[model samples]
Target: MLPDLAAMSSTSFQITATTGAFPLEAGTIFTNTVEVNTTLLGDDPSNNVAETAATVFPLLYIHEIQGSGDSNTMPGAIVNIEAIVVGDFQDNDGDLFDTDLDGFYVQEELADYDNDKSTSEGLFVYAPGATDVAVGDLVCLTGEVGEYSDQTQLTLQGDLKICGHATLPAPVSLTLPVRDISDFERYEGMLVSFPQALVISEYYNYDRYNEVVLAEPFVDERPFQPSAYLDPTTEADAIDDAASLIARSRITLDDARSAQNPPLLRHPNGAPYALDNRFRGGDMVQDATGVLGQGFGIYRLQPTVAATYIEENPRPDASPAVGGSVQVGAFNVLNYFLTLDDGSDICGPNLDMECRGADTPQEFDRQRAKILAALEEIEADVFGLVELENTTGVTPTADLVAGLNDTLGAGTYAHIETGTIGGDAIKVGLIYKASTVTPLGDFVVLDDPAFLDPNNTGVPKNRAALVQTFQDNRSGETFTVVVNHLKSKGSDCGGAPDDDPVQGNCNLTRAMAADYLVDWLSTNPTGTGTGNNLIIGDLNAYDK
Candidate 1:
């Protein structure tokens, strides 16, 4: 017995005993059992000996063909490989049948058969629109190893055989807070279970793709520090931590159901998990057993079993009205518009594509329902509304008022009309319960330097604030309420001098607007001759 050749390349090797001292006939084949060592010197010497016939074709494992290289492409030709089907898209035993990531991922049955952590034991089968196989089926396949996008997957060649059903491998236990980008490759296509519950942080793509981003905890983060510390290092560190948490601690949960906006959503208990109308950002989830999949630059947890959902944030009831004779309120109505979302220029000065509200009448109806609910719940006598669609009509503000009053009664709520103020598609308006308060005069809107421009933000740096005097019908008490939505820090007046090193975008404009607000409020802009005022609105330029 000798030593192992660094390692054996094939399953079988042969040796001949045609010694140098003796010559054999041309037709003679060596019959001597020339022993070969298949182990290292450190290994047992007696157990190292081997005798076998060399073969033309050799069996290859999935990892051997996959190799350990990080590059997408495999260098050598791969004849064939075998693995059990951990994923073949047959997991849908019931109505749920979603496989949006496409392609099945096959992995070796036993855990770490070759004991090489550097190489992956699993490989994705990139045969799209082909789904004849079932999960847990053992398979032997011949394929051309090419990378589809960045994923190293096998494009099936010749005829593949599903040997039979077998016990699927146990799922790998993986936890969250994946700090590095490359940490997910090992678990790709492998059955994995999250160790702890993940909260649903984003559901904007819920209806579109049945996709939800889940984090270990809530991620509805606020931008700026509440205290005015203004420390650069602290701010940078906080921002970095926040950014990392957003990217690192999330897994995209893809629904197994092929349907969109399924009528019945349930918890793991098989009861309704109804967190608000849809699963909002704070809903907790657990018992998510899924195949880790990647496509289009997103890693999706394709659930083998439906994930258990806990309604962390339930549907909120209407807010209790504050006990006051003059009930003044401020509401941000996230851009309410009446023009049937035809994408025509709602605001004359803005581009037609600037339409940001509901894209359809049905959508508008849905949005109107929510706004109506919110306002009616507030039950405020005086309401200063912000972010209404800027358009000129006989009653541009009437649509919302009509929608509100329809819910609260025909004569319940009415809003002040300013026609069209600025060119931008969003503006502020005033609304009040007619039974509770009366409008003394017309709603006043300003486009001056203080209200609109600061650091010369090219016209309206701030939304045109509307000032209107409301008289308490019973007590004859009159006060002013101005609704102002200032320039937001995001993409605000983004020119050279306007950008602040510490305060960031549009801070100067907001400061100037504040100064102008104080001076203008001193004079009583609406001029009921009343100094008693309630000036409340969002100063958006202060945050990241």
Candidate 2:
């Protein structure tokens, strides 16, 4: 009679000992006992299994035949059966499972089969030596426990077979674009480098030449002083190198004495020297000999080197009264050139040196010619000229006035020099004919008095504002004209966005000047009949 298997529950058993080799055949069952732990079956026993492994306490049945040659096993028989571990088994065979085809294995399948089974859980069964058994191959797995190694190892109950080798999904791809740099060609002359950003502080057209110019006044950090150089061999060099030279040297007094004596006099008649003719006003003297001797005491020495000078003289042939209207002309003479065209050999081939090699005679001649031409073009009763230099240390103001009065041969002209600030040689001035407008005297407005320090100061004299007042001779009207050249925006003007109230100190100064002028005008009105008051010059600010 068949052993009664009806009372047996479907259960898992661990092979206590294997009597034969692996790939156990059907009907070849050895004596195997059902484990006391019920968790030895199913995919992930750590998590509660929906169905526990069948219990086979009294006896177990050969319910199904698995593995090679296991099909003939009879059901309900107490067969010492070799079981086939059939289900989803992944091994060396590439047929049963594929990642590209079946997708990834579920996480539950890879978890421990039971809390007590360490090595058996999440372990896949595989047929060794199968083509799909290569390293890096992945496959699905399913099996039964044939033997046990303490609490860790698991042995196959039947033939370990391959389900399939997994195939990896295809890799992903990407793309990116390139950039261009063509527009930077125009900035070639600026001495700029690549991948850099340069911020311009200020840009404007200079009124004289009407040439577009850029200024970065913020760079002016300190006063400009001429660098002193001395030759090592000369006796005068000893004085320059003396230990107490800066303090004990009497260059000013020595300079005065040198001016009194001339080694070679310009006048052949042996006449007494006129100060104006004997020495060019702004010339500086350098003596090689340290001796304070007799001949040097009696006669002045000619200047070894003259100061850098530029001059602008008014047109001698100007006739503004004929037109009955003032025409003002602004020109940048482009260094020291009297004429717009090339004439003298001084400049040679270079365009920058228009009046080169010009002696006093040539300078006078060239200046007269240019002034005549400019006056004819401007035809203004009043004119403003900037960037003028001259020999008298008086600048171009007096010379221009004198020249115009002499050449026009009609009306007398007078001018007042508006001195410089910040050690700049360039000064602005006004030239007008006495026949059209009478000079009413002029005064200078100084920069804030609070900036003056007794210990340290800039450029000797403080920054000042020059204001000149005049009267219209023809109309008998009084006009107060305030001429100004305000501080430029490039320096210490704070930064953007300009709307911020805290920044723009230079703008504040300009505003202060404007307000000061307004207040002055309010206090000192022109004449009774709505006096013709005009405020002019480079205000250095944009009109609101």
Candidate 3:
């Protein structure tokens, strides 16, 4: 129906209306018409009326919302949308409100024939309530278009109908060995599968963040003093390429679980995700399928299935006779402080200052258990441990030894009494199997002459050098076991300070510690002064 233009006296006019609930779903199309001046014909009847055909887009295609131009959201358009479920936040349990993940993601079922790979084909459906949608379901939903948390998503408004079940589109194959977010921009919100197998190089924030760094090869720490050419242009380009390399080649696999420290990481056989230690950096996974996503300042692969990880890198037993008859081993405990982050002040050190290991009691227990399990697998008779609390009492070191020996049999192990050799929050510890070897002489610790002054501290700066002599019973050979924890290149030991090429804070201090170690060892710091010495610990320096 049209209002006569005679009253307004205009040759042209426009009409708008709020239509009834839409009965048609996505992919359905038909034509209709519009007419003018039906009641009376004008003087020129040929120009008095006309009919124009229109085809309804029941739901806007993902490409329409994600414009092919640039990174910008579609301003205002409330329309229906259709996509298949790819990333569901809801686990087997129907609970949804208990997590920070308030939405599931949907990706286009098929790639457009003319797609230029410029825009995302997937969109997150922001559903904070009970959800009827599941993975592999093709759904037609009417929702208000908007961006939440800087991500393009929809808020369901009217109907959410699961039309039917269909086979999901063949996943877009992805490969590693590159590092750019733009490479993934076009594939974002689309079902993507990787070709090369990837190792879970590291857990995202100790497994609580629910993500893993997947790389074609192993992930290594950035060098403290990165080598660069004098040519600024080449250096700048290399730096940029290096920066992009990580994001391009390595994809973060985000777990669908929303809880902190979930216990669901299991092996293919349904056991916990570790022989000891949660998926030791080299644990591998293959051909993962998920919706490529970007959020919270990170790009992620939200897997369609969380527990289907194939262990390409399985745990192996350590080789015996690693060294002499003692089988000595070196380990970086990753700040194995005995402190608990229990709310009460009674628990040792807090996470803020002296605390490094675990925060809560439960976290502490779990962390310690994992560490012990990992150590048990090492099966080392003598362990040179770094990142341990340098406290005088055995509250920290003795507790760890007792725990290890408990699984390894009581009276089997003993920790060296270094007696607070350094002022650093962490230091190296010496623990030996009492049955396999005997502590021959007193252990020696060299605190820096001035406790490490500025200018790379001249001395050790942070942790001190711990040296001991152990007698291997079978071979009857005594070797000097030197455990050293040097100044790390992390934190803010920058130009006002260390002035390192890489962001790893203190390069000079660690260098000075090595020099000091050489000088002191020549003098035989241990009473026995055995030339047969095995010097090991995290010196905070890389050979490459």
Top candidate by lDDT: 1
Error of 2 at 350 (Å): 33
Q: Flag regions of model 2 displaced more than 4 Å.
A: 1-372, 389-392, 417-424, 441-463, 489-505, 525-531
What's the TM-score of each model vs. the native? 0.66, 0.31, 0.69
Q: lDDT-based ranking, best first? A: 1, 3, 2
Ten-residue segment with the worst summed lDDT in candidate 3? 221-230
Give a tens-digit lDDT track for model 1, residues 111-164.
Answer: 535776656677777554554677888877666677654567777654567767
Residues 410-512 of candidate 3: C-alpha lDDT, one tens digit per residue: 9888998765555555678888889889888788876656325435434445566678888888888888888877666656454543645542467665655
Q: Poorest 10 consecutive residues of model 1 by lDDT?
A: 25-34
Candidate 2 local lDDT, residue 241: 39
Query: Tens digit of lDDT per residue, candidate 2, span 1-544?
Result: 2223366464453323332233444433233333222333343656433333333211111222111121212222222211122122233235311111111111112221223211111211223332233322433232232311111112233332333443322111110000111111111101111111111111122122111111111122111111123332354435333322222211111121112222323211122224543322212222211111112112111111122211122235744365534434444432332322346433222223333323466666776567656664565666655444321233456666666666666456666655433233333467777678776755444344332111132322212334456667777666555444555555553343322122223555565556766655565533331345466666655443
Better of 1 and 2 by lDDT: 1
Model 2 TM:
0.31
Tell me the lDDT of model 1 at 66.
60
Error of 2 at 425 (Å): 3.2
